[model samples]
Target: MSAASAFDDDIRRARALEQANPAEAGRIYMSVLEQDPANIEASNALERLNDPHRYSSWMRINCVIDPRDDIFRFIGTGPYSHNPIREYLSDGWRTLSELMVVMDKLDQPLTRVSSFLEFASGFGRFTRHLVKVLPGRVACSDVMPGSMEFAREQFGVEAFYSSFEPEQIEFPRRYEVVFVLSLLTHLPIEVWGRWLKVLAGAVAPGGVLIFTVHNEEVLRDQLGVKFDETGYSFLPSSESPSLEASQYGTSLATAQVVAEQVRQALGTDPVLWEECAFWVGHDAIAIRPHG
Candidate 1:
């Protein structure tokens, strides 16, 4: 190890601000750890950041966010344009809180789940806070290679590759909570249910598969969209940079349409569908097989 220099003073400042301004403190710790991953002071402080009860600001906001994470770009807005890094991290926590509510509705709290699968997880946005909550049990999957790796190395969890073709997407094993947040909201009409069927298969027996969608209300109100005869609509654009927009564009559907897709995907419809359960636009549909 190298001798400490001005970095020690930075750590001191971080310590002094821990209670008064944890967000700034965490940002400082993250900065230190980024420079010296072995710094005990910053490492220990980051460990504390994983506390579920700690303020949302306790987690380091910008430890390793790639500059290419387009979602981060999308989140940068208004005052956040100056420092979207902070809002990016807080926004993840917001998603976690929303999931907790869904779990409660399903009678399956986060504490009870033995394993979790975050499908289409991008760049550890929600994965970061999720690891703090689920820890060792968390697993992530995405077509983007670096994303899963980033989550595994930074957050300490399992990760695997997901393919564009639903039949080709492999899983190491089943999970009690298989969350496909926002992915369905973007899949093109041609292969929506095909992807849904494959994801549903990843859910352990008696477990829930929770996925989000842009429902009719959100489409009509937010995007001024009108669903076609198929009861859904899509546009060939999104925040992604790699995936072809034609296949991974934005999509919206009515609750009835989404429920039918779930039924057709899994041959059953034991789904708990809630409209505008989050983001005041995305609908959450959690499906579990019949007893």
Candidate 2:
């Protein structure tokens, strides 16, 4: 058959099998792409099938769990509280949506970004969605090797292992956007300034650094403390001495304190400071000045 006729036939078959046998349908759609690299319909179909959000509950459960890695279990079940899978997915969506807003306000549209770095990425939670939205080379890093492996294998992103020490970790190159989600919230006060500087330095000049941190509001509700007076608070993890406790312990900072930390670390005032902007749960946005 002619190329046009063959493409049409493949498209019809792929659509027919999508709901019942998406894997096979995906293969067929991918083959169409191989024949015609610019086939938008086939490309869209393939992307839809591969989207984590569209995955079945069984698939999500499997994706979130790795027998060798306990970080997945901790993040999924710990912060999520109830219905881990659903909440995790929802948080990813909410984070992406809010990031879009931040980008728009900053005049840095997602389309303009050519590379992204997700620091402290845990099992591709947000990295998966970021890849879909950014259309860039997405690289994820975590102190845990298993988490990095899981993100690279499951989310189709480049991955690297990081060190707990801010100065020890390195990247292949700077990125147009560096995302730090739920990471700063757990760092101890001692490393806060240094980590912020290191992460901010990863952004290309004129690029943006977006991060989430527990604000004063959280401290008030959870610990009955006022950040304005104390600046920051840290609740030592009960699981101390374990990596989880050191990396996932409860910490909070006031907006002023966060901005001050950014200024001290990055040598510039934060561009935006929204109390609980991330899923209504973090503060601060900084942009690297362009030369």
Candidate 3:
């Protein structure tokens, strides 16, 4: 077989081995890179592997990860340096790809978006990649300390202080495309609708608000959690160490539950919906506030 097909075969085999034997998967990716140093596919895969995550300037992003940014720390390769910053940087590209599909589904091509917001943008993992595409059009907000500053300084995008209480977060300006990734999946039910309304207000007239959420059925089936009639569940625990457990725990809700919240917040049905479109299991939906 050709070298291209050989790389494909190796990547496929490595992916199959990742869950059961990550070391073997990393070795396979390393072998691919040994043959082809500039292979984007191998580079992205290897970056995510925590088997001593090293940086070889795979993507060559000229940004620094915050020391307190637990999101980056979780997958990073070392204690002193953020070598796996590559994964935090590259996995964000996949997020961009997902947003492309959502934007197309809403008839709002991402390339044409005049302004964008990444709400609750923890450590700018995805925002870094977003700035590469939209540049000056991008703005990021987060409650995490130093998150907004790092985003602004490193990516040259707008940055704002975010609050746990959505009502307290007044934006510098509204956005044509407001994207909230992995945030609703962590909010309690009491504030879910409130936050949704606040985000709806941040969307420019005729613009869309996009976000990701954990599926309620997945909560029940995979996590074995019992949901009430509202079809919501909260674990009061998460990987984030900066936020309060009760305030920013893991959340899951059904489409019906989320739809009602949207109706109450934006007075409109979702313009686009996709199950497991983001992060493989989180549901993604986009709604136009003006409509």
**Candidate-wise lDDT, in order:** 0.76, 0.69, 0.77
Can you give the lDDT of residue 224 in candidate 2? 76
- My TM-score estimates for the predictions, one after another, are 0.77, 0.71, 0.76
Regions of candidate 3 where Cα sits further than 4 Å from its true position:
1-57, 76-83
**What tens digits encode model 1's per-residue C-alpha lDDT throughout 1-291?**
323365999999988998888888888888876675434456557556653322343564424565446676677543434445556667788898998998998899987789999998888888888877776899999877587777777778898888888898779999888998899888875687788778878889889888888767767877788767888777898877677998888876777787787777778875677777776688888888533
Top TM-score hit = 1
Error of model 2, residue 261, in angstroms: 1.6
* Per-residue C-alpha lDDT of model 3 across residues 1-291, encoded as one tens digit per residue: 114465898899998998899989988888886775434456557656654443434454534556567776555534432335455666778888988988888888888889999898888788877877786899889988788888877789889998877899989998998999888888887787899989989999989888888766677788777767878777899878778999988887777888887787668888777888887588888888888
Residue 267 displacement (Å), model 3: 2.1
Compose the digit string of candidate 2's lDDT tens values, residues 1-291: 114355999999999999999988988877776775434456557556773333333333223333334443454446434544345455666777877777777777866788889887766667767877664488989876578878766677888888987888878888888988777778787788888878877888777788877767766786577655668777767322346675558677777777777777777776766666776557646556442
CA lDDT for candidate 1 = 0.76
Pick the winner on TM-score between candidates 1 and 3.
1
